[model samples]
Target: MKLYIAEKPSLARAIADALPKPHKKQDGYIEVAGGDIVSWCIGHLLEQAEPDSYHDRYKKWNAADLPIVPETWQLKAKTQTRKQLTILKKLIKQADELVNAGDPDREGQLLVDEVIDHAKPTKVKKQNAKRLLVSDLNVGAVKKSLSNLKPNSEFIPLSVSALARARADWLYGMNLTRAYTLAGQKVGFKGVLSVGRVQTPILGLVVRRDLEILNFVPHAFYEVLAHLNPNLDQDINSQTSETFTAKWQPSGACEPYMDDEGRVLHKGLAQNVVSRINDQVGTVLSVDKKQKKQNSPLPYNLSSLQIDAAKAFGMAAKQVLDTCQNLYERHKLITYPRSDNRYLPKDHHKEASQVLAAIKNNQGQEASKVDGANTRLKSKCWNDKKVEAHHGIIPTVKKLQSASLTKDEKCIYQLISRHYLAQFYPEYIYNETQVEIEIAKGKFKTKAKQEVNLGFKVLMGKSELDSEEKLPALIKGQKLLCFKGELIEKQTQPPAHFTDATLLAAMTGIARFVKDPEIKKVLKETDGLGTEATRAGIIELLFKRGFLKRQGKQILATESGIALIQVLPEQVSKPDLTAVWESSLSSIAQKELSYQHFMQPLLQQLSDIIELSKTCDSSAFKSLPEQKPNKKFRRKRKTYKKAS
Candidate 1:
């Protein structure tokens, strides 16, 4: 008997249908012919042990328990998923053949292998793999993948990296949160006080901007404009003339910036230029045409997909991940959703068309869902060479199980469908135009763009296209109308509040505002800010702790948040640390550096940062606007006295 495991039950069922003599059981799993047995776990059935789980005495929170950093982390079956573990265990023990069939990524590998650890499989086990790594849950793809499973050892490095990430997050989050909460409580605040490695730096960004706004003062500036009536025949070079014609040439255009406070900071005498023209003839400099092709974007990886989905359909990041997971595991319409790589191996290109053809046949499915109409194309996001550790998010050509879809699932499906079809659709082609004008001593210019061809427009089948802004051409100096645009001074805006989108952007890279160019260049190898998987949790930690506040879509840092960075004796909130750590991790991944070599400095820095920040003065940070200094918050009383 062979035991097979899958990421989810829906997927297990799909695999079971392909095998012979399948028997489905409620608590257990489906049994197929030839004495083969298959089972599944829903996501992570086993997890790293919690601090409270370490001992009965540590079950509750207390101030004395400042940092619950564990030396030897253990594993346990999660309470929510123990039953599935039991089923898998029972099958693994009796079966003669074993297979690791989890989702095909770090998280997926963790889910399956950890369960195996729980089951206590025998050594020297000859396991056959059910490598069903397709985006769609179709029968053909699933069956093909099962027959080609590789040995488990091949994925050891991936599992190692995943586990390391998990451990690091746990260590950083637990210890920091405990320390911060205790520290805050000592100062009369009674909040849970949370902290995360990724989140604190992120919160710092918001806090800094808020301070700039609070400290800002506004100012104004003045300038003049003239409506020009030029001659059409002779070429009048405005660049050579000395007058303020550039500012007056346009009907609509933007001037320039402001200083610290929302004020127009201007310096030096105003500059201007003028040109002599008969206002009769304007000669066309040149009308140039060039053919340009825009290739379809590479397939949807985790972050890119999330951003695009959010922009196009207003979906949340977490929501997009969940839907993509379901589509991959249940419907089997797509590949892995948690991947970061957008490129594929050269080998994958050969069979790419099968996916394309499937979507084309299911036009209604390969296209996005339309309102008030049943006839439409289906959705798919696929690329062969463009895929990395996993292929792009694409729908499998399999006929969808429409009944099983929830409302959210349908929306996700629509998002995936549109992206997939767009790949095979044609390259977007357009004609671009550039124009230059010189007026006044200062040069003023305007540009106009015209669309000649939209190649992939046919794939959308006359669907609504993105909007464009362009104006009819004005050949060289052919001035028909005279419109003098006045110089309206614009005050500079304080840095914008961090929205979820902007926060994510800032979190994605470790690039800095540092003065040194060399230091900035080194961060290129480092994953920006944080990976997609960890960024949300980091932000959540900030909110859970009083360090950050959520006001509708905007993220504001709390007083504590500002103070933490201000008093931090060193740059704990700086991206420099992230960059250094990233460079080390890249070295580790390439076998060029060992873990000890990488972590020793980190541990030292951690100690230095914690000690330095704990003892430093926070005067500058405390004065920030976010704290609303002098305003008091009433302390909440957790303990009540009755009938005194």
Candidate 2:
């Protein structure tokens, strides 16, 4: 019998449905019609061994033995998942061949491969392992994918890269966390100073934002506006000849009026400029008309989906991921959701019409609005060169009703479906008009935009359509009336606190924070800070560990969080080290570099960080209070008085 293992039960069940007839169900696996057995893994069945797993001596955290680097890595099966492992091991012993049917990514390849390695069956060995990669879990797709299984060795580099990443994380997280926590212990700070490759850099983002918000000083700025009425031709309608407002623009020698921050700092000068331009008839110096087109956005990658979902429905990043996963796995309504690539393989274009037809048949009124995208429209989203392991999240050919989905599921599904449908729609077209007027040697400007077509905006719903700001027809020499100029006083705001949307943005493009150009370039070339699948969890970890908290939607660093950054060296908190390591991981994946090459420098850096921790002072965290004692005390004299 051949054993086929999947990443999740839903995917396994779907594959089973595609196989030939007569199948028997067991406790942990299904004997398929094709003399093969299908089983499933609940994500990762094995994890990296903890520090205590290396040796008993490492159980206790000590400053002397700070950098704990294991010579050979160890793997331990998750206790909760041991029963499934037992089932897999039994099947492995009975089978002559095995198939690795995990998700089509680095982590997925490693997840199932590690489990098989743990079982250590002599007959069912890695030499005979086959890989089954399928983007969709539908019956036809599964059957086609199974017929074309390749040797698992083809993906060795990906697996090695993932292992390198996991080990590197363990080295940094374990050694650095122990080092800092021990350092803090000596200074009366009673908490685990948890650190991570991605987690610390992200924590630095919140801490820096908190500091900026705390130190910000409000400054007032002023702007001058004029209400102008232009002369209208007799042929024009009376309603179309209405007046409009224009802002006073600093010109010629008035450059000093604005400061470096783009604020008009001198309020008196603004008032004087306003007074000079007041009641002055200005000729329209120029009227510029330009037609512009905004193409539909590319489909939803996990990060963009998370950012958009957070904005639209106030869903947290993890919540969005969970919902999308549910739609992908349980509902089988969409393709893989954990993808970072937003572009589809060029060959996938053949299936576009079928997916559209499925949508047109299943979706009711919403489908009618998508008639524009129903045709064979070529899109930039279909570029094989740009696609990686998986494409953007898109609805599968499976037919499902919006009524069948939950509220959150419905919203997320709509978001995914609309983006796909938008690919076939024409670009949103509009004309922009800019009018510049001159009055008393000062210039005033006003701009207007008129929509030529709704295009893709129609699928986004009626409210999302752009509204036109009508401007009266004017000639270059036309003169207009100027009402009394008014000064609008406003205060400059500090950088807004990071919400889930903004924080994810920062985490995705962390190169913006790095000073080193080489590190910044590498971070951009590889995955920034964290994978899309892991970013939400990192932020959630910060919240769970009490290092960060939410004030409304804004993320704020806790006292413990701020103190942790304060005590650590800049190398630990900054993005450069982690980003450089991430670039090395990318190199391993590309076969451009080896694991030994990557780990050597990382291990050396870990040792250096440990050494740095020994000399680091933790007195900066003296003000941060630890958990207070819960026990309350009473005097014995009270009991004596009561007895008397």
RMSD of each: 7.6, 6.2
Backbone atom clashes (below 3 Å) for every candidate: 55, 0
Residue 56 of candidate 2: its Cα lDDT? 68
Which regions of candidate 1 deviate over 4 angstroms? 24-26, 51-71, 118-123, 126-134, 212-292, 344-386, 400-410, 438-442, 457-486, 509-523, 536-552, 558-571, 575-593, 616-644
lDDT of 1 by residue, 458-545 (tens): 5445623244334344466544322343445554456777766666666665475444577678776565776655566566656655
lDDT of 2 at 35: 83
Candidate 2: segments with Cα more than 4 A from true spot: 119-128, 232-240, 251-257, 357-365, 463-469, 475-478, 623-644
**How much is 488 displaced in model 2, in angstroms?**
2.3
